[model samples]
Target: MPELLYWLDLFGVVVFAFSGALMAGRYQLDPFGVVVLSAVTAIGGGTIRDVILDTQVFWIKNPLYLYVILLTAILTIVLIRCPKRIPKRFLLIADAFGLALFAVLGTQKAMALGAPISVSIVMGTLTGVAGGMIRDVICNVIPLILRQEIYATAAILGGGLYVFFNYLGWSENFSIIFAILGALKLRLAAIYWQVSLPAFQIIEKNDV
Candidate 1:
């Protein structure tokens, strides 16, 4: 189970790093920018979670993560010479996959650290979205988490499902897979339909 999870984590990192590099490409950023963005998008959330938990950052503790991110970013740069031709769907699909995996993986890690269930869920959501948030902010784009979108909602739902499944004595792999699918399906549905949560509004006191 542990070994399986490790592989999944590495794959997730590659997917995420590719997505970030693609975004950098969209902005016509140079090679260094691509690598920097890729690294942050691949490991930012996990780094934040580990720091908050008072643990060594995952990639720092194991250089394998760095190697994968670098390799993925380099490959993206090579293969995507004209990034403008890259379809928007590609990034969205990559993000959905990364979100689902990181959300559940982060929850599991928090649980391993003996965090409370509530905190674990929050951490999971953070792991899924925080990197994207930073990436968007740095690129001068609005972060998806701040939008009235179903993005973080999907992450929360995945984290919640994983916790629930574990509590029911489900096998770890089954629980993780089910939770990832739940989040991925919802995110894809939202993207297909352009679904978003209703935004909150307030009436102006000075208005008629």
Candidate 2:
């Protein structure tokens, strides 16, 4: 289980780093800026989760996380000769994958630490969306979590399903796989179909 979590964490880090680099490219940030954004977006949520859980931050304990982010950023720079222009859809897909992997891994970690199911669900959702939130804020855009899109909703649903499956005595591997796939499916659907939750609207006194 630990080995599976480790590899999944690495996968999430790489995908998240790629999304961050793509964002930096969109902003035409310098190489240093790109690296910083990539690192933050790759580990920001995990850092927060660890701090809140009173555990060692994952990247702080594992230098491989940093190395992965750096390499990912460098590769992005090399591949995208023109930083200012890239397909937005590619970034969205990558972000969805990262979100799915991180959500499952975070829930598993929280559960392993004996956190309550509710707390684990929140942690999972946070892990999935917090990094992207930070990245969007830094890039001067509205964070997806705050938008109408099915972003954090997917994470929360996936986390709930994971907990439910575990409670039903399912195997850890099966629960994890189902959770990740479920989250990814929902997120990708939202992305491709522009599915979104309804927004709140305030009516002015004059209109009323």
Candidate 3:
């Protein structure tokens, strides 16, 4: 289980790093900016999570994740010089995959720390969105989770499903896989359908 989580964590880092690099390229950022943004987008959430949980940061304990992010960013710069040519949906898909992986991984780690179920879910959602939020803010864009999209909801649902599956005595792999797919599918469906969450509207009474 530890080994499985380690590989998934690295994979998540790669996906997010690549996504960040692409974003930088779309904005015509320099190579250094690409690396900077990629690193933040790859590590921001985990950093916050570790600090909040009072644990050693994952990349600090094992610098291999940092190396992975650097390599992924370099590769994206080399192989995809023209990120503008790539469809926006490609980036969204990559973000969805990264979000799904992190959601489950975060919940698992929080649970391992003996966090309560609700706290675990909240941490999982934060793990999924915090990095993206930072990246978007750096680029002066509205964060997806802050928008009326189904971004955070996807992470919450994914984390909740993992918890539920575990309570069902399901296999470890089954729970993780199910949670990742559930989140990814929901996010992709929302993107493809241009679905927006329903907003509440209430009448305001004028006290004139």
Candidate 4:
């Protein structure tokens, strides 16, 4: 079980790392900045999760994950210099996959730590979105979830589904596949239809 989670974590990190590098490249950031954003986007959530869970940082304990993140970032930088334009559409697809992967991994970790379902869901969403949020902040842009776009909500739905299926004694592989598809569908649907959360309304002040 531990080894399974480790592999899932690495896969999620790779997907997010690519997404961050692509975004940084699009913004024309220098190579160093690109690598920085990729690292943050790949590892930020797992760092937070480890801190909150009072465990040794997962990536530090497993250095291969960091190595993979760096390698992918550098590879992405090379792609930026290619003559062909990289499709922005692929970034959304990568983000969806990353979100789904993190959601299930986070939920499983939280459950293993004996957290309740509500807490597990919150952690799962945080794990799914924290990296992207940090990447945007570092890149000096609005967080993706705060935009009029679908992001964190999709992660939450997927994480909830993962926990529900697990409680039903479903196979781990089946649960993961279901959660991943749910997240991808939700995100793609929102992107295609421009669905978003409600914006905050300003309250009028009463004259005394």
Candidate 5:
């Protein structure tokens, strides 16, 4: 189970790092900046999760995470020579995949660490979205969750489902698969239908 989760984490990191590099390149950032953004976007959430959970930082313990992020950024720089807007579309898809993968991985990690179901769901949401949130802050834009993306909501729902299935005595493999699929479908549906959460608003004193 541990080994399988490790491999899955790698897959999620590569997708996220690629998407981050693509976003940084679109901003016309310098090569160093591109690498920085990619690293932050790929592992920042995991770092936060580890710190909050009092676990050794995952990427620090596994240098492969850093290696993958750097490799992705370098490859992106080499392949993207046209300097057009192509990265934007690719990044959207990659982001969806990253969100799904991270949500599942995070929930599993929390469960392994003996967190309660609710805490695990929060961890999942953070792990799924924090990287992108940091990426957006670095890029000087509002985070996707703060917008109408329904991004964190999808992660939370996926994590909740994983816990629910596990409580019902399902296999870990099946539970993880279900969680990933749930997150992926929810995110894609939101994107396809342009579904979004309503923005928070406050009534004016005079109106009230």
Candidate 6:
């Protein structure tokens, strides 16, 4: 289980790093700025999760993750220099994959640490969104979670389903797979169909 989680973490880091690099490219940031953003987008959520959980930060403990982020950043820069620009949709897809993987992984970690289901779900959602939130803030854009689209909503639902499957005596691998797929499907559907939750609005009244 630990080995599987390690690989999944690396995968999530790479994908998230790509998304961050894409944003840096869009803004025409220098190479150092690109790598900095990639590192933040790759590990920001996991760092927060570990801090809140009082666990060792994963990347600090395993410097391999940092190496992976550095390699991913370099690859992204190389891709950026290609004749074709990276598609905007690719960023969304990568973000969705990261969201799904982190959601399940966070929930599983919290559960393993004896947290209750509710707290586990919240941790999962936070793990899924934190990196992207930081990325957007640094990029001076509205965070995707704050957008009308079902971002955190997908993570929440995925986490809930993970707990549900665990309660049903499902295998850990099965539960994780189900949660990731569920979250990814919902996110992709939302993106493809432009589905979004209604925005909050305030009305103004003039008094005589």
Q: Please give the clash total of every predicted structure, in order.
A: 0, 0, 0, 0, 0, 0
Winner on lDDT (2 vs 4): 2
Sort the candidates on lDDT, descending order.
1, 2, 6, 3, 5, 4
| Candidates sorted on TM-score, descending | 6, 1, 3, 2, 5, 4
Which residue pairs in candidate 3 have backbone atoms (N, alpha carbon, C) closer than 3 angstroms, thus clashing? none
- For residues 45-89, write the lDDT of model 4, one tens digit per residue: 878987998889888887888789889989877765776586767
Q: Each model's RMSD to truth, in Å?
A: 1.8, 2.0, 1.9, 2.2, 2.0, 1.7
lDDT of candidate 5 vs native? 0.85
Encode model 5's per-residue lDDT on 1-208: one tens digit a residue.
7677778899889888988888887678899899999999989888899899999999878787898889889988888766654734577778888888998889889889999888988998899999988998888877777767678888888888888889899999888888889988999888778787886787778754
TM-score of each model, paired residue for residue? 0.94, 0.93, 0.93, 0.89, 0.92, 0.94
Clashing pairs in 1: none
Superposition error at 110 for model 6 (Å): 1.0
Model 1, range 1-208, lDDT digits (tens) per residue?
Answer: 8998999899889989998998898788888889999999999989999999898999889999998998999999898876548777888788888998999999999998999999999999999998888888898888767666579989999999999999999999999999999998988888888788787798778757
lDDT of 4 at 151: 86
Write out the backbone clash pairs for model 2.
none
Candidate 4 segments exceeding 4 Å error: 1-4, 197-208
Candidate 6 lands at a TM-score of 0.94
Candidate 2 residue-wise lDDT, 61-135, digit = tens? 889899999999999899888664667698889899999998888988899999999999999988988998899
For model 2, what is the C-alpha lDDT against the true structure?
A: 0.90
> lDDT scores for all predictions?
0.90, 0.90, 0.88, 0.83, 0.85, 0.89
> Model 6 misses residue 119 by how many Å?
0.8
* Model 2 alpha-carbon miss at residue 144, Å: 0.9
User: Candidate 3: lDDT over CA atoms?
Assistant: 0.88
Please tell me which model should have the higher TM-score, number 4 or number 5: 5
